[model samples]
Target: MYQVIPPCMELRDHVSHFWFASWTAQQDRVQPVYYQTASCLAELAFAFRSSELVFASVQGHSPHAARYNAGGFLSIFGVSVFAYSLPLLFDVPPAALSGRFCTPEQLLGREGALLVEQVAGEADLPARVRCLNDFLKLRLRKAAEGDHRIIAAARQVMKPEVKFDLSAFAGECCLSPKQFERRFSACTGFSPKLFDRVSRFEYLLNNHRRFTTLTQAALASGYYDQSHFIRDFKQFAGCSPQRFFALSGY
Candidate 1:
């Protein structure tokens, strides 16, 4: 089963949601699940009853899916962080984390280890989530304030129907193109163009049911042609759109 909890009021600006999942092995072997890359969010996950804590970067540049194996009794608790908020909670640049998964220790050092210990000791999902929320609040206390302009720029890029103009947008943000690209990449793990593409693709995936056809959805999400949409769908979703929707029963 999988569930999501909304972020606390104070964390609403930085966190998208908190999620939990648990599964029991049906067979003697591991069952694998594949996850498509998310463009706007990064995840920090902890494996309950174990010392495993991992940070997964938002899928950028790489088209590959993240794989996880499930066996025995498994429980997972995770935080979905808004892309722009990663640097506020962790020391690593989002660019450095792109297309990779790292141990919490690698990302947070001693503090990450302590967090794992705390969560692992807790058995209830709500308590674990509360513990994680407290940890994030503490991190927020020490971090620098986020740039509202950049955050607004990110929100602009996510609008599915809007045609993104990088140079013009950068000027509006009072940043040179190069400066804007660097700062945006640091926060989102993708250049402005790539981020725009991924965000568009994500919008299509989420709202495809409202459209009658893939081509229609593609066009509405800003893809110029069906081929371009298919290529992007394969890259980020690891499958053709038809196959993905069929398998997902969407």
Candidate 2:
């Protein structure tokens, strides 16, 4: 089973949501699960029965999902960080994390280890979420404020049906195109063009039900043609649009 819960009010600015999942094996065998690439956000995940906590990056260039094995019983609690919000809570730059998974100790030092122990001790999911919230609050107190302009730009990029002209958008933000590209990459781990591409793909995924056909979905999401849409859909999702829709039960 999988579920998503909204972040607490205090965490809304930096965190998107808290997600949980659990699965039990029907037999003594490993099951494979493919986690699709998300090019616009970062994730911090804790496994209740394992030490390998995962901090996954915005996979801007990766063409395949992250694969994992599951057997017996497994459970996970994850914090979904909003785009560009990682630097606000952790010292690591978003660009440094692209297409990689870092351990808690690698990202947070000794404190991360202690947090792992504390979270593992809690058998209840809500209590574990509270612990994570407290940890994030402490980190926020010590961290510098993030630039709001990037967040604003991200919002604009995500709007459906908007024509994304990077040069024009950069000018509106009072930045040269090159300057905008550099700062945007530092903040979101993706160049403005790449971010727009990913955002368009995501829109297609989320709103496929609203369209009568895959071609319509592609065109409505801003792809210029079927081939362009299919290429990007395959690159980001690791499957053709038809297969992805089927797998996702859309």
Candidate 3:
């Protein structure tokens, strides 16, 4: 079963969005069989506003293996909180943050093991969240106030009906596509095109069961066609929408 828990407080204008999340299941606790295409599965998922980094631990089996899909990776071990800023902090990237993992150096932009120690030690999640909120507020304040331009631009380009054309966006952003890409890469660690695809794919999945038919779901999310939609869904989710959906309901 997948469950999403939203942050209890309202964030300042600068914060994108945030949530605490968990997913769990028992073999016989729910339906035993079901199926949907991967694209279909994309219609239902936990979408975050700001970039999110979570600290989690597993109890029974391999927590890492049990909790995430193929693209998920371990940046560190143990129950540690993860820090996630919006992709705007990175600019547009090649992939959405789902299942994406990075080295500590890549995410922090420096080498220090303090985060590790923080995770390994006793942590009061509520208190830690308070501290994290303070930290994010400080960072957001130091950065230029108001909505970041890059984030605004990215949001505009995220429409499901349109494919992200980097060259065009680069021109709009007033930088050569290569230069734009570099800035975006430094900020988010992935390319713009990939981010667009993944984000929209996620959008579709979040609304998967919301629609009456699979085709309706695909079209609503901006997939060029059903086949193309299914192809990308499998590549990213590691299962067809139908099967993934069935398992997701646990």
Give the candidate number with the greatest TM-score.
2
Q: Please, what are the lDDT tens digits per residue for candidate 2 over residues 86-168? A: 78877778777777777777778888788778777766888888988998888888889887887788778877678888888
Query: Which runs of model 1 end up more than 4 angstroms from their true locations?
Result: 28-30, 49-63, 210-216
Question: Which residue runs does candidate 2 get wrong by more than 4 Å?
Answer: 28-30, 49-64, 71-73, 210-212, 248-250
Q: Rank the candidates by lDDT, best first.
A: 1, 2, 3
Question: In candidate 1, where is summed lDDT lowest over 10 consecutive residues?
Answer: 54-63
| TM-scores for every predicted model | 0.84, 0.85, 0.57
Query: Across residues 1-250, which tens digit of lDDT does each residue of candidate 1 receive?
Result: 7898999999998887998877664565646464555456777876643434333222223435555554433667788887677778886667776667777777888898888788777768888889999999999989987777877888889898778998988999899999999888777777788888878987898688889888888999999998899898888777888788887665
- Please tell me which model should have the higher lDDT, number 1 or number 3: 1
Candidates 1 and 2 compared by lDDT, better number: 1
**Against the unseen true structure, what C-alpha lDDT does each candidate score?**
0.76, 0.75, 0.45
* Prediction 3 global C-alpha lDDT: 0.45
Question: Could you tell me the C-alpha RMSD of candidate 3 in Å?
Answer: 9.0
TM-score result, candidate 3: 0.57
